[model samples]
Target: MIELKSAGEISAMREAGRVVAGVHAAVRAQAAVGVSLRELDQVARTVIHEGGAGSSFLGYHPSFGATPYPGVICTSVNGVMLHGLPTPYRLRDGDLLSVDCAVHVDGWHADGTVSFVVGAARAEDLDLIRVADATLAAGIAAAVPGARMGDVGHAMSAVGRGAGYGMQNDFGGHGIGREMHESPFVPNEGRKGRGLWLRPGLVIAIEPSLIAGGGDDYHMASDGWSVCTGDGSRSAHVEHTVAITQDGPVILTVP
Candidate 1:
């Protein structure tokens, strides 16, 4: 069921959102060439610990997961779209990195993601990242009251298709609350004027992940966690936790 948060609940959620945003900011600044994904996870752990927040990803074992997720952050690089488990692999030049983090404060949860190039930025890499970012923003813009969930998906599709990029609907955003991955799945491509109606206090994660190639096919890595493009092309992902309100969409996980 889609639970509409109360005013008090929204306040608590904002606290969680603040921590999530701070963690993303810290990770973005600390990301650089030669840094290990494990090291980046440590940075996120420190931020969550210092802020007295709990990790929403750590120890999380979803139905699709093989084991309990052991990291506080997800470090998806290049072809990996999402759920790239942290490892000892170090970053290299021209690597497009996607960092996803979530935090819980006083029982409320917030999630966010950021994708950027580590050292040297390729023109195509920059374009992919930029388009993903803009696509996420457009998705958020569709979260206003009275808007259907399909409208959000439509906006996301327009951004990706307009850029000549294929949509990866295998994984997308979802409603989030006391637990992560709540009701009302949000896809990256869909028709408008369909699905659930948006209302005040409905919070959802609007994540737009895309590959620069021309197909939506993807493959799973041997690690049983990371997912990569089937064509081996680079991928980018951007996300923000947004809330529908009487005033419109409010970005809760802003950095």
Candidate 2:
């Protein structure tokens, strides 16, 4: 069921969002050439713990997951789209990396993702990341009180399509609060003026994932978690947890 958060609950979520943001900042700083994905995950774990929050990703066994997740953060490198397991794979210069992290504080949850190049970023990779950031911004802007969920998706997909990027509709954003995942699945693409109507206290994660090759097809990795582009093209993912409020849409997952 769709659960609207109270003002106090939203405040608690904001605190959790701050912890998630800290993890992103620390992971981004530690992500460099020669750094292993596991190292990055450890960085996130440390930050989450120091912030007095618990990881929502660690031990999380979603319905599709084969086992409980072992990492505090997801480190998707290059063509890997999402749910990339943190292994012993070391980073190399020019590698594109996307880090996804979620945390809970006082029972409220927040989730977000960031994509960037490790070192010596390629022009094309930078462009893809830019589009992903723009797409996320558009989606967050559309998430205002009185707007429909489709409006947010439409706003996000429009930016991706206009950039000639492909979107993965199979996996998208969703409501987040007491639990890391909640009701009202938020698609990356949708028609305007359709889907759930936005209202005050409604909080959801707005993530926009774009494939550079302009194809949506993807395949699962042998590890049973990592998702990669079928065409072997690079991808970028960016996200922010937003709350529809009486005044406007407020982004909860911000540093």
Candidate 3:
């Protein structure tokens, strides 16, 4: 069911989001060539605990997964799209890394992610990351009170389409609060003025994922978590937890 959060409750969620943001920042700083994904996960864990927040992602067992998530943060490298499990593999120069994270504080939850190149960044890879970031910003801008959910998706997808990029509708953002995942599924692509109506007190995560080449095609890895481009092309994912209020779309997870 869709839920609305009070101002005080939103403040609490913001706190959790701040912690998630700190984890993202700390992990981003730790990520570099020769760094293992597990090391980045360790950095996130340390920051989450130091902030006095509990990881909402650890041991998370989604309906589609047979095993619980083992990492505090998802470290997706290169062509790996989403849910890329951290492993011993060391990041190489020019590797595009996407990290997704969530944490709870004062009974509220917040989730966010970032994609960055390890050392030297390729022009196309950099552009893909820029698309993800810009699309997320546009999506958040449409998350105002009284707006339809479709506005957010349209705003996001339009950016992708205009840039000649492909969007993945199969997996997208969703409502987030006391739990990691909630209701009112937010797609990265959709028709304008359609879907659920937005309102005050509503909180949701706005994530836009795009593939370098155009299309909705994607493939799930054997790990049952990691997803990537079907054509083996590069991809990028960007996200933020936003709150719809009278003031506007408040991005709670900014670092």
TM-score of each: 0.98, 0.99, 0.98
Q: In model 2, how large is the Cα lDDT of residue 14?
A: 97
Rank the models by lDDT, top first.
Answer: 2, 3, 1
Q: Please write out the lDDT profile of model 3 over residues 198-247, one tens digit for every residue.
A: 99999999888888877778888998888888878888998899999998
Q: In angstroms, what RMSD does candidate 3 have relative to the true structure?
A: 0.9
lDDT winner among the candidates?
2
Task: Please report, as a residue range, the 10-residue window in candidate 1 with the lowest summed lDDT.
Answer: 6-15
User: In candidate 1, how many Å is residue 146 off?
Assistant: 0.9
lDDT of each: 0.89, 0.92, 0.90
User: Candidate 3: what lDDT?
Assistant: 0.90
| Candidate 2 residue-wise lDDT at 133 | 97
Q: Give the TM-score of candidate 2.
A: 0.99
Which residue pairs show collisions in model 2? none
User: Which TM-score value belongs to model 3?
Assistant: 0.98
Which stretches of model 3 miss by more than 4 angstroms? none
What's the C-alpha lDDT at position 57 in model 2? 91
Candidate 2 off by > 4 Å: none
Q: Model 1 clash pairs?
A: none
The order of the candidates by TM-score, greatest first, is 2, 3, 1
